[model samples]
Target: MAFLVDITSHLNHLNAQLQGRDQTVSDLFAHMNAFQRKLVLFKEGFSFSHPNLAHFPACEEMRRDVPECNKTFHKYRADIETLQEQFKNRFQDFYAMQPQIALFTDPLSATVSEQPPELQLELCELQSDPFFQAKGNERGILFWRLLPESRFPLLRDFALSMASMFGSTYICESNFSTMKHIKSKERNRLTDETLFHLMQIGCTNIDIDIQSIVHLQERPQVSH
Candidate 1:
């Protein structure tokens, strides 16, 4: 139970990191790569000869009471291996697009030879430019957008396509949740048109102009 709790806690943390807005495929891939590396470290930590529970506080706590906790290390190691396999299999598509992802994330370091023939010259020029070299520090979608469309049309378009790729269903799921909240049983009478506008207002960051709207409305006139 302690082992399960520790593993679940780590998984939950990764899930939370994967959530949120403005996250491009590159950002999600970076998080996944980091988590995969952590899983490797975790597998090593579960070694029978030298158990390392630094990251697994629950397991460490149980070890204090039960020194024979190392008995479960083999099972834990197997589970970690399974997890590693699952992650690799699940993100195989991402692995296949790694070259494109690398180009989008770090054009400065990307190999010009690996890129498409049309993009090769543009990529070379972009990499050699001192102005872009300094600006290359910016990451993900924004970095791709920073490229001048007129200068590096092919490279910029390719990078933008990769950068625009959907990394997760977080935004879609969040919108569904917001929609559910807006059309709750208490507000079941809301029409589709009203609901649409309400959802737009609810999901958007734009501030409503209440005072201006109130002033524009026709007020009831008082009779003397």
Candidate 2:
């Protein structure tokens, strides 16, 4: 819902901006339509002067972008449909588990009136969670906790939440690379405590002396 709402809000802002920009954008739109007609005529093997082919960058760019835009729209719509299907399933399961969780949590005080309506529904879902049911071996690291995202339905659903968002794993890999840099052959002879301290300092954005932390008492301090 937030994703859809944000997209709608931004689109409204864009429409409003264009409305106040006089007829500049409107004239460009009209010109583009004319350009498209010319391109279609060219594609039909009609003869055109050399000047026509020379300035087709705008036309060429539009040609390339149109197919990509269609693909992007299809993917966005498909994702929305998939989310709706999953939410519908989770919504039903949430209500069905209400009685069970209420019984387990408390019987006489189990009525919906005793709790916030949405919270009661969410608590019921988490308590009877298929993911948090403590079969860690069957699941994995992701299913180990539920309180972290009690508002969400299942661990699978929470994991799928950012499935479409992509990012570089460089930061994770950089931690390993930095640790290796600190533990070079010349500086390899160190206690476990010292090695751990050095690795931690190297991986973080902060620039501090690992030896100073490990040997704090021995270091000289300036008089305040």
Instruction: Report RMSD (Å) for each prediction in the order shown.
Output: 4.5, 19.0
Which window of ten consecutive residues has the lowest lDDT sum in model 2? 45-54
Q: What tens digits encode model 2's per-residue C-alpha lDDT throughout 1-224?
A: 32355445543553444342122322223333353343344333213221222233443344355644322322333444454455446445434544533333332234545554644565466557665555433322223233465465443342343232222344456677877787778877867797787677676667777456555666543320
State residue 188's C-alpha deviation in candidate 1, in Å: 8.8
Which predicted model would earn the best TM-score?
1
lDDT of candidate 1 over 123-224, digit per residue (tens): 888889898788866876667777788998998778767756778888889999999998989888988998998789888878997567667868822210
Residue pair clashes in candidate 1: none
Instruction: Give, for candidate 1, the lowest lDDT window spanning 10 residues.
Output: 215-224
Candidate of highest lDDT: 1
* Each prediction's whole-model lDDT (CA): 0.85, 0.43
Q: Please report the TM-score between candidate 2 and the true structure.
A: 0.26
Task: List TM-scores for all candidates, in order.
Answer: 0.81, 0.26
Q: What's the residue-level lDDT of 98 in candidate 1?
A: 86
Clash number for model 1? Answer: 0
As a whole number from 0 to 100, the lDDT of residue 125 in candidate 2 is 61
